[model samples]
Target: MIKNYDVIGDIHGHADALHRLLARLDYRERDGAHRHASRSVIFLGDFIDRGPEQVEVLRVVRAMAGAGTARAVMGNHEFNALGWATPDGAGGFLRSHSEKNEKQHAAFLAQIGEGSRGHHEALAWFASLPVWLDLGGLRIVHACWHAASQACLAATCLDSAGRFHGEGLRKAYRSGTPEHLAADVLLKGPEVRLPSGHSFRDKDGHTRHEARLRWWDREATTFRLAALGLEDRRSELLDDPVPAECRYEEAIPVMFGHYWLSGRPQLLSPTASCLDFSVAKGGVLTAYRWSGESVLSNDNLVWVAA
Candidate 1:
C-alpha cells in the first residue's frame, strides 16, 4: 500500500498540464515514468477526451500505472468508451452509436485515431479499470462515493479480480436497471430531474432537464444554496435545495473529480473535496495531496495552469 498519495483530478486528455502538475508535486520523469521518492499518485480518472493530446495522456498514465507509481479509477469517459465499443448482441454497439456519444468522444477519437489498433487496445485497457478505489485512509471515485452504490457494483459488476468487465460490465451500463443507476450515480454524481416547467442551459449551452446536485452539502436549503457546487450555469436553475433525505450525510475523507469547477479551489466539505477544476475547458488541473489526514485543508491543493 502507498503511504502517501497525491490525489489528482480529471485530466480529460490534457497531458501537458498533467505533466506540469506532476512537476509541481515534485514528481520526476525517470526511466520513462513519472516517479516521486516517497509518494504515489491516485488518479481520479477522466484521462481521455476533450483535449488536444488524448493518446499522449494515455501513454503517460498507462506507463506510470504500469510502473506501480500510480493507481487510477475509471472515470465516466473511460466507462463510456467501453460502452460505446461493446457489442449489443444484436447489430449496434452497447451504448448505441449515436451522434451525441460520438460528439462527446470526438476529441478522443481525433487524437487516438478512431477504430485504429491503438484505440481498440486503449478501450480494452479501460474495460479493466475499477470504478472506485478504497485505500483505507483515502477513498476515491470519479464522482459521488456512495457506500450503497459501491456495494451494488461490487456484487453485480465486479469480477473476482475487481474489474468491471464481461457480462457484469455490460449490465451495469444498460440503462434503466438498478445496476445502471448505481454505476451512473457513482460515476456521474447524484442528479435530480428539474421540476416540471423548469429547465436550464448548461455551461456548454445545452439545455439540461436533469441537474447534478451538490453531494457535499447537507445544509443547502434553497435552490441557490443547493446549486452552489454545480459546475454549470445556475442562473436559470430552479431555486430549490434537495430534500434532506437525498443529501450526502457522510463524514469520510472522500475525494472525487468530474465537476468542471472553476475559480479558487477549496474543500467541498471538511472531509469531502473535488479534485477536478475543468482542465479540459481551459481550467486548471488540480490535485489534493493527502497523507492520512481525516480533515482536509486547502493548503494541500495543487494545480497547473491550463
Candidate 2:
C-alpha cells in the first residue's frame, strides 16, 4: 500500500507540464518511471486528448502505472474511447464516429491517426482501468460519487477485478438503460436540463441547455448554486436546484478530476475536493498530497503552471 499518495488531477496530455509537476512534487525518474520513496500517485484520468504531447503523456503514465508506482481510475474520455473502438454487431462502432465525438477526441485521434493498432491498444488498456477506487481513508473517481451509481456499477459494469466484463460493456452502452446512466453519472458527473430557453456557451463555445450539477452542494437551493463547477457561460440559470436524490451523501472524502476546473485548487467541502485545473487549456495541473487526512485542506494542493 502507498504510504503517501499524490492524487493527480485531469491531465489532458500536457506532458512537459506533467514532467515539471512531478519534479516539483519531488518524484525521481528511475528506469523510465517516476517514483518516490514511499509515495505513489493516484491518477484521476483524462490522460489523453486536447493538449500537446498526447503520446508522451500516455508513455509517462503508462510507464509509472506499469511499474507499480501509480494507480488510475477511468475517466470519461477513456470510457468513450472503449465504446468508439468496440464493434456493435451492426457493421458500425459501439459509439459511432460522429462529428461531436470525433471533435471531442480530435487531438487523441490525430496522434493515433485513426483506427490504427495504437488506437485499439489504448482502448484495451482503458477498459482495464477501474471506474473508481475506494482507498478506505478516501475515495477516488473521475466525477460524481453517488452511491446509487456505485451500486449500478457493481451490478452491471465493474467485475470482481474492477475491470469491465464483456457482458458489462454490452449493458453499459445501451441508451436509457440503468447501466448506461450509472456509467454516465460516474464518468461525466450528474447533468440536468435548465428551464425552458435557458442555455449557455461552454468553454469551447458549445451551446448547452443541460448543466452539469454541483454534486458536492448538499444544501443547494437553485440550479445556479448546484452547478458542478465554474465555466465560461452566459449566465446562471437561477432555476430550481437539483433534487435531493441528485446530491452526494457519501461521507468518505472524494478527490477527482473531470470538470476542467480553473483557478487555485481548493476543497468544495471538508470531505470534497476537485483537482482538475484545466491544464490542457493553459491552466495549472494540480495534485493533492493526501496522507491519511480525513479532513481535506486547501494548503495541501500542489501544481505547475502551464
Candidate 3:
C-alpha cells in the first residue's frame, strides 16, 4: 500500500488551480497522467460544477485515477449529478429536473452535454467511487465521518467496498429511508435546523434554515458554537445543544471536503481537517501532505491560489 498521500479538496472544475496545486505538491505529468514517484493523491471529490474547465478537470482527474496515481470519494455534487441523470423509474429523474437543480448542475451540463458519451462515462465513474476510504490510520470522506452513518450504509446501500449499485443505489436515492439518511450524512455532512426565524445566507447567497454542524468539535454544545461557517451570525443563534448523532467521536485522522472553508488551511482538530477552500469562489485549491501521521498538523497543508 502507498503510505504517502496528498489528500486534495474540492476542485469545483478549477483546473488551473488544481494543476498549480499539484505542481506545488511536486507532482509531475507523465504518460498522460500526473504522477509522484512515491506518493499518491486522495481526492475528496466535487471535481465538477460551478467553475470553468469542468471537462479538463475531469480529464486530468480521470486519467490519474485510471493510471492508479490517485483515488477519490464521491462528493455531494458528483452524487447529485448521478441522481440527476439516473431514471427514477417513475417517469422522473432520481433528482428532479427542477429549475434549481438544473441551474446548480448547468456548468457540468454545459461542458459535458447530457446523454453524451462523456456525460454517461462521468456518471459511471462517479457511481463507481466509494463514499469513503478507511485507510486504517487515515480516513478520507467527502463530508462528515460518522461511524453510525457508515455502519448504517454498510448494512444497506453500500457494498463491502462502500460503493452503491443496483438496489443499493436506488435505496440511497429514496427519500425517508435509512439508506438516504446514511448517504446524506456521509456525502452532504450532518446538518441541524436553526431556531425559528434564524436563517443565514450561505456563500452562494442562498438562505439556509438548516446549518451544517462542526461534528469534530466536542466542546460545541450550543447551536452557535456547533455551526460551521456561521461565525458572523453567532450572536443571533440560539443556545441549543446539537444532537448527539451529529458529533464525530472517533480518534482516527479523517480528512474531508464540501465545507467551502476560506482563509488559511488548518486542522479542525488533531484528527479532523476540511481541505476544501472554495477554489471555485476564488479561494485556494488546498491539499494536505499525509506522510502517515497519526494526528494531523497544519504544517502539512499546501495550496495554490485560484
lDDT of each residue in 1-306, candidate 2, tens digit only: 535899999888899989999999999899999999888999998998788788888888888999999999999988888888788899987788899888988889898777788877777779889989989988999998878888987976779867788778878898999999989999999888877887778888889878888888776656767765433442656656567778766677898889887777788888998899899888999999999988888889999998
Candidate lDDT values, in order:
0.84, 0.85, 0.90
Highest lDDT against the true fold, candidate: 3
Judged by lDDT relative to the true structure, which candidate is superior, 1 or 3?
3
User: Residue 101 of candidate 3: its Cα lDDT?
Assistant: 91
1-306 in candidate 1: lDDT tens per residue? 538999999998888998899999999989999999999998988999889888988998998999999999999999888888888888888787788788898888878888899999899878778888888877889998777777888897898665785888888968898889999989998777766777777787788777777777777665555664343555656676566654667656889999888888888888888988888888899999998888899999988899
Error of 3 at 4 (Å): 0.4
Off by over 4 Å in 1: 221-245
- Which ranges of candidate 3 are over 4 A from the true structure? none
Cα-based RMSD of the predictions, in order? 2.4, 2.2, 1.5
**Lowest lDDT block of 10, candidate 2:** 227-236
Q: Indicate the residue-level lDDT of 294 in model 1.
A: 82
* Model 1 poorest 10 in a row by lDDT: 227-236
Error of 3 at 147 (Å): 1.0
Give per-model TM-scores: 0.92, 0.93, 0.96
lDDT of 3 at 158: 76
* Residue pairs with backbone overlap in model 2: 213-228, 214-226, 214-227, 214-228
